[model samples]
Target chain A: MKFSVVVFPGSNCDDDAFQAVRSGLGQPVSFVWHGSEDLENADAVILPGGFSYGDYLRTGAIARFSPVMSAVKRFAAGGGLVLGICNGFQILLETGLLPGAMLCNSNLRFICRPVHLRVENASLPFTRSTRVGQVLTIPIAHAEGNYFADERTLAELQRQGRIVFRYCALGGEVTPETNPNGSIDSIAGIANEEGNVIGMMPHPERASDARLGSTDGLYIFRSLLDWFEQMRNAECGVRSQAAVPHSALRTPHSK
Target chain B: MKAKVFVALKRTVLDPQGKTILAALRDLGYADVADVRQGKFFEIGLSDGLGAEQARQQIERIARDVLTNPVIEEFSYQVEP
Candidate 1:
């Protein structure tokens, strides 16, 4: 599957995402400018991390109003796969594709270090390859990664299993100390109800390569590929069945 | 017309900066201070041709939707005619 890495004006992680997909994973990938309205035949779009628009008027607020966001919204509405990492996650929240908003870290400091994330839901396309309750070490770098939602929204998310990952210790135990940010319920990543769109503060692209000290993040990308392949195979099966006349089909017992 | 908008975190939300400031204040021997909250202020100058009432409504809309995030923040505005 082809992947498009969006490069906003201040997107610093665009190159990292591109390299991870192109070199690390050996997938077809390209960089799409934030001003471009078209996704350029990309099956999956990655909104890489960065302080877009200098994080002015709030992180992701101004970036959401950019021309490319309209196209991204359209793409998402069409059931296209979209992954927003870090600042990209903030943009997704601002775009209303994801619920909740980011607040300042509880410590009021920019945290940049590897943290453990437990796979909360393994049935979604983003985490299907991961085992539930598995701990993956991924690096998070942000000052406003604290996630918050209203009680109703939080209940809905929990009930729907939209939460894809949670901050946890090495033993897969979720605790306040493991939560680098004061995110409600230690939420580190979440997906939309349909699970096609996912937003996470931790940088999976940064951890995809073994040289980066961890290869656990590669499972997420691998899972997407596996899901897409299954979809394609299912579609092909339906088409092939339609090609044959009903009369030509015979019951296996009769044959 | 000129307007001032105040944006602040919702009451239910935790404000780390506000808590840090409160701690600092207490450390400075201001023991009587009960609490502290941090917020943002914006002074907007409108040059639209609308009348005072119309401008006030427009500024309110802007402050509610643009100057603040409804999910995490609350905003109040005062207009000067």
Candidate 2:
């Protein structure tokens, strides 16, 4: 599957995502500039981590207005899979594609370290390879990684099993001490209601290779590939001319 | 005309920066300091073509839609003639 990583002006991790998909996953990938409207017929879109627009106004307040974001929003509305990591996640929230917002870490410091993440719901396309309660050692680097949502939104996300990942201890335990950045309920990642759009504070691309000290992040990309393969197989059996197998085109949601 | 907008974190959300500033003030001998809440300020200049009401409406929309994140923040703005 072809993955398009959006490159904003201040984005620093666009190359990391490109390399992760190209060298790490052996998949075709390309960079989509923020000013460009075309996605190059990408099957999936990735908003990589970085301080876009210098994190001015807010983390993603300005980046959300990028010209490419309009295409991303349309792509997402059509149920195309979109993954936002770190600052990308913030942009997703700002775009209202995902619920909630992010805030400065409770400690008010820029933290860059590998942290443990527990798979809260593993049935989604983003986490199908990860088993429920499985611990993933992914690194997160940001000052405004703290996640926040209104009471109703939090309850809804919890009820719908949309909370895909949560910060936890190595033993797969959720505790205050395990919570990095003091994110509400230690939310490390979450998916939209349709499960096609996902945003996470952890930098999965950074940990996708063994040379970087961990390959646990590969599970996410592998899961996407796995889902894409299934959809392609399903599409071939149904219609031969489908360019992109969207969520609506599929029989049932990947969950 | 210029619009002065102030955006502040909602009371329900914790402001770590404000808390740190409060602590710093207390440590610096401002014993009477009770609380602190951090926010953002933006001064937007309006084009001369806009009338008074149009400018107010435009500024209000800008402040709400662009300046502040409604989920964790609230904003107030004033336009000066």
Candidate 3:
């Protein structure tokens, strides 16, 4: 599967995402500049983390107007897969691809550390490689990572199982002390209603390599590849309920 | 024409920076200080081609769609002739 990593002007993690897909996941990947209006046949798009537009006007306010975002929005509307990490998650929220908004961390300090995340929904394409309630150690680095949504939206997300990941302890306990950014409901990540778009504060790319002390992040990239493989087999009329159920693959844009 | 916009976190949202400032103020012996809510201010200059009504509309749009994230923040703006 081919991946396109969107690179905004201030995107510092583009290379990290590229490397994760290319070397870690062993998939073909390319960097799509923010000014580009096309995704260039990308099977999946990734918005990597960084302070785009110097984070001026707001964390993602300026970057949301980038030319590439329109293309991304269209791709998502078409049911194409999109994974947003860190500041990319902020961009996704600002673009309305995902619900809710981000606020400054409750402690008023920039947090940079490896935090544990519990997979809340493994049936989705993004978390198919993990199990429900499984804890993975992933690093989170940001100041405005506190996720916020209204009570109604929160209840809706909960009801739909769209809350994909939550900050948790090593033992898989969700607690206030374990929430690094004070995100509402301990949310570390979430998926859109269609299940194709995912936005998360954790830096999965940064954790994809063993040399980086943890390869737990590789599961997310692997899950995408797994999804693509399952899609390809389905296209060939080969029924394989090996891992993900055929019913779970509701991705309409898979080709 | 010119416009001024002020943006602030909604009442339901928590403002850690504002709370920290409030603590500092109280520490300084300002017993009457009730609260401190941080906000952002912006001054925008309009181009010559726009009329008064047009400028007001444009500024309102800018403040609504750009200056504030309606999910968590709100804005108030003033246009000067």
- TM-scores, in order shown? 0.93, 0.94, 0.94
Docking class of 1: medium
DockQ scores of the candidates: 0.74, 0.92, 0.89
Question: Candidate 2, residues A18-81: lDDT per residue as tens digits?
Answer: 8888878877787888988998778889999999999999999999999999999999999999
Q: List the residue pairs that clash in candidate 1.
A: none
Best by DockQ: 2
- Name every residue pair that clashes in candidate 3: none
What ranking of all candidate models by DockQ puts the best one first? Answer: 2, 3, 1
In order of listing, the candidates' clash counts read: 0, 2, 0
Better of 1 and 2 by DockQ: 2
Task: Name the regions of candidate 1 deviating beyond 4 angstroms.
Answer: A238-255
Q: Which portions of model 2 show Cα errors greater than 4 Å?
A: A238-255
Docking class of 3: high
Superposed Cα RMSD, model 2 = 5.6
lDDT of 1 at B72: 93
RMSD, each candidate, Å? 8.8, 5.6, 5.3
Q: What digit string (tens of lDDT, one per residue) describes model 3 on residues A37-89? A: 98878899999999999999889899999999999999999989999999999
Query: Model 3: per-residue lDDT, tens digit, B5-53?
Result: 9999999999888999999999999999999999999999988777989
- Compute the TM-score of each model's chain A versus the native chain A and list the values: 0.92, 0.93, 0.93
